[model samples]
Target: MAGPWITEHEVSVVEDAMRNGWYEHAYDYCEKFQAEFAVYHDRQYGLMTPNCTTAIHLLLAGLGVGPGDEVILPECTWIASGAGVTYQGATPVFADIDPNHWCIDPESVEKLISPKTKAMIVVDLFGNMPDMDALQAVADKHGIFLIEDSAEALGSVYKGTRAGKFGIGSVFSFHRTKTLTCGEGGMLLLDDKELYERCSMLRDHGRRPGGPAYFNEEVTFKYMPFNVQAALAYAQFQRIDELVGKKQEQLNQYREKLSDIDDLQLNPEPEGGINGAWISAVVFGKSHNMSKHKAIEELEKLDIPARPFFYPLSSLPAYGEMIDEYKTRNSIAYDISERGINLPGAANLTGEQIDKVCDGIHRILT
Candidate 1:
């Protein structure tokens, strides 16, 4: 039942959009939101999309990734990260994640690259990041594009660079559960002008930009965000620090509560990096005999909400034809996923709730 923390600010802008956003002013909020969001990520351009999945589809299409092409991404991610590649008629090559960071492993990515590989989709999973420098080096060596799926790492930083600033293009989600939400929305951030312009065109059915009204030059997908959603997102964006800070605080509370649990590994804070703390997760040690299912069962009995960490993408039935040796190839992904559990990370989650959850974990493990 956790929800976004909203105030009169979001209500006011949404009302403004509903009342005055029309015709000539229809895109006012969208444009403003897009620009400011991109700048926040230190990118030169931003294109709003209906959702993160649509944004991924748009990025794949804009990059001309199609049949016969392949995209490498960590197996430990949401389905959208892999499903989007299939929409482009491209094959998704699943790689193992770094056990410590829970993001795409650069070494695994390097081993997966091939002549068919056109891009690498590095997901910042659960607000955690891998070694971006090593991944970037691999991409550069192979002459492939680095596309960041930063849907969960909005405020995460690595070596002083924002999560969305590492790749040729990055996509972020503003879903209801995210730190910054507009009910349902996403954005594409990038520094390349040509790719941005091309994606912009693709976002609106490939209408020739400024050539003519209703003139379509090529056939493509339309993933533009509506003004009302932009208004809500923009309102949330205005309080970005507040939203992100609350998540960090929530994570701190979890760390304090679970600090004594030696059998658990909480989200990491690497040197020179700041974890966005989107969803606080804990992975029980293999020797602890506490699987994700068992942990969730115990928490549910105590009326505590919990979620399982993502399953290995290759193990899903939808991807069975693509990779069959998921257990062997992605041992770390499969291993951690079984023991990892996503704790309640709602901005409004109370300390008492966190204490109760941590107590449940301690009781189960001890």
Candidate 2:
């Protein structure tokens, strides 16, 4: 796997956290990072978590989603999105994705809404935003909550608004593979003070802030994020623009290198929308003789790492009961997964390395 672009600043901040970040200073980095991240996204509050999955689960709990409820989500996403719903004893209803955008189709979402539907989680798949206006309209019409799973879209913008600024709340990932990461961490961003406060207390064993010491209001999950991790994340967060720019640069290089290939489609940059370009991905056209499986095999022989796009969640054994209809239910997602693959776009990768990858792909396709 390609590693994140780490610098001396991360090392220094972590060292400081290890030495001086204790007791009263334990959450210094976390507070600073959370506040800045929230401000950047125009959110009123932010809560740090061990990882994105936990953040999604906590967010769902905060929204009061539970047994017998159904949450709508796109079929093409990491299981983390669906698993969180199950944690709340809610059924995750999979929806199809837009052919070009690869995000949950608003129409598909509307079709699946039922009396059991409590909320919809829209994933900013591969750092690309779906039609938020339409999705929000659907949710508003149905009186169900809308949540944004922006794990891969930290820097993405839709209509001048950042990825995390939409819906009732949004969750982000700072995994090793993410654009801005501190090994493993996540953040919940939202504008609702009531929801934020509730999740905050619930995140720490249900101990209400400023309450009696060692007292608990209710039983809940603990998804605490430590100071050292926060320090590392804060350091990276300081260079957010630089990191996002480098990711975009990598994607730009790939786009230029593959400009002559009309049968390939890279991540989209719709008018007024800025793609985060977190993972440089491409989907081979149906007319292309190449398939993702073939591409991966050829790239492997050439020593290039090619990551496959996510399979429809319904096709996984864990959701086997829904697998039979997945192909017809989410045709665009199934088709895209078959042809799509993530390219090597590490921020620290050299131009020579990118050229090699492009050349290998060219030769394989030809």
Tell me the tens digit of each residue's lDDT in model 2 across 1-366: 356989999999999999999999989999999999999999999999999999999999999999999999999999998788999999999999998989999999999999999999999988989999999999999999999999999789999999999899999999998999998999999898899989999899999877899999899998989999999999999999999998899889999999998889999986898999898899999888677889999999999989888888988888975767778878888899889999986668999999999999888888
Per-model C-alpha lDDT, please? 0.89, 0.92
User: Which pairs clash in model 1?
Assistant: none
Determine which window of 10 residues in candidate 2 has minimal summed lDDT. Answer: 320-329
User: Each candidate: how many clashes?
Assistant: 0, 0
Best by lDDT: 2
Q: Can you give the TM-score per candidate against the true fold?
A: 0.98, 0.98
Off by over 4 Å in 2: none
lDDT of 1: 0.89
